[model samples]
Target: MFRFTDYGEEDAIRLCKELVRIESTDPGSYEGRISEYIYETLRQELGADGVRLCRSEVLTGRRNLLAELPGSSAPAGSGKEEPALVLICHMDTVVAGEGWSEETGGPFSAAERDGRIYGRGSCDMKSGLACALTAFCREAGERRLRQGEKAPEKYRTLRFIASVDEEDFMRGAERVIRDGWVSASDWVMDLEPTDGRIQNCHKGRVWFEAEAEGVTAHASMPEQGTDAILALSYFICALREEVAKLPEDERMGRTTITFGQITGGYRPYVVPDHAKVWIDLRTVPPTDSRMLRELLGRAERAATEKVPGSKFRILLTGDRQSIPPCPKSRLLQSLRQAVREATGEEAVVSLFPGYTDTAVIAGTLGNENCLSYGPGKLRLAHKPNEYVDISDIRRVMRVLRCLLREPLR
Candidate 1:
């Protein structure tokens, strides 16, 4: 068993601050620089063979970093091997937009105040990344020190995956699964700033674009041409009414929809010929792509019937399935015990309201042994002047260290 001191809390905090200073915003640097930094850091500690970069096919220059610590073979004649544990953390952050107080020292300042580290991605997840990195490096270093000393205790293989593009499409996670880095039997965990809660499930997410086309007409002409903007507005109202009819889930609550972006007419003197809206839906169980398509079809028919010349179409942008709660999960039980041992407090099990890489990993592999547990609060993510408590980072490190020390079943 490994002690908490094996990975110093102070070291984890320092690494978190350093990571916060790097501007690895999504759609900006796109995790290129941060991936390189992590790759080089792990290579230095675990050697080049233990760490490698997997470039993303969808995004240029962006890559995922994988670091592995292989475990000893099971005892002779056991006829079974321990399942591997995959720890995932994304290296990208949402853009650090304008608004910030002077105390924050700008978006990439990595400033410290009130025992918290402030900057973009500090709370969203850089702190969790630091904890994972520290724990992995420390465990690898310890193993190296104990080489050739009798028979080492058997442990599960540990894989640390630093993915890119989690803030946008989760293309990095898709690539990781496609590349066979994670198996169906392996347990997956994403460090996604869950406020130290053990989140075993998350809501489904679907993003689609609705385009409405109509004939342009002069402002003085009434009923001469259908208004594309009015048609899309009618569709939006119809969709909301349809979604309101969906039954609410006990754990995940009701499915909700949000209009993220809308573009319509440019000038006031003319009726626009084209209009579009980007819709985001947070879905519950029993809601799949087929159901979504039907819902959109109904709404489109409603709009077309109301506006004679308007034609509507939908383009799906992204889809991520919801993960249901696993109350009897062995991984959940083990993690809860580790949390109790590390913090002397019971772990609170809840559903993560937002989607995470664990959702993609679990859904793609049909693996129920997946969860999210980490430092910082989810509310702080994607906001300016974001910060993570230093104590929270230390606590997560302690909990993760305890969990990693135990043998996987």
Candidate 2:
């Protein structure tokens, strides 16, 4: 059996700091450097034969890494096959925006203070990645040690995937699914900073860009032309009203909408000819494409009626469907058992408000056994002075060790 020790905890923390220092900021530095670092590190730990890197088809010059440990077969014609377990972590983080505290050095400093690791990706996820890596490598090493033993315990095949572009369009995950690296029967878990809770369901997401068009006019002739900015404002109000009518869930809460970005008039002296607003909708069940279309239609009609000659257009930029909750899943039961053995406490089940790579997997591949559970708080992700407690990483490592050591039916 592979056991986690004090030294292993220290090594996991160190690995997290190194990952944070690599600067894999999405839409900024990109994940090339960090991907290379992870590929090299896994290669060294698991050997070249056990690890492979695949270049992303969507993102240029970026790659995803996969490391595998094959499982032993059932003994003496028992006619039993072990299931495969995939551990997933994204190698990309959101851009290190402004508002960082000087005491933490910088956004990529990966500083340690009072048992916390501070950096851009520290809390959002690098800590989870470190824990998963440590657990996987330890198990692989133990399997190697038992090579010549007379009777070693049979275990499930284990695979660790480090994907790219998770903070953006999730192209890496799409590629992983397209390449058939993961099947619908395989158990998958994404380390997405769930604050140590197992998130069995995820909120659906849809990104929209609403454009309002009107004739531009000079400030002196206010009545000569319509204002697109005013029309957009009306559209926003109508959209909010429509969104508020959507159904709510007890676990996932009410469907929410956020105006991420808006642009209107160029100058105070002129009536703008065009205005656009980017909207994000986080939805729950019973909120499907037909409902979205109906809501937008109602909002557009209300806006155009209020502002005559002003046309409104809505575009669907992205859509990620929700994963319904599976409280009685075998994967959840296994994880709960692992948590009990590791921490002597019952596991908490919850719903993730935001979307994740596992959403892409479940949506695209119809995999219901996938879930997210890891170190750090989701609230601290993509924010200034993000940090993860060292103790949290250790706790997650313990849970992962217990999970890896057991057999998944």
- lDDT tens readout by residue for model 1, 33-73: 77878877776666654444344454788888778787775
Candidate 2 lDDT, 297-340, residue by residue in tens: 89999989999999988899888988898877777889999999
Q: TM-scores of all models?
A: 0.94, 0.95
Candidate 2 least-lDDT 10 residues: 1-10
Q: After TM-score superposition, what is the CA distance of residue 6 in candidate 1 from its true location, in Å?
A: 7.4
State in Å the error of residue 381, model 2: 0.7
The runs of at least 3 residues in candidate 2 whose Cα sits more than 4 Å from the true structure, single-residue gaps closed, are 1-7, 48-57, 74-80
lDDT of 1 at 120: 96
Q: Would you list the C-alpha lDDT of every candidate in the order shown? A: 0.86, 0.85
Off by over 4 Å in 1: 1-6, 48-58, 73-79
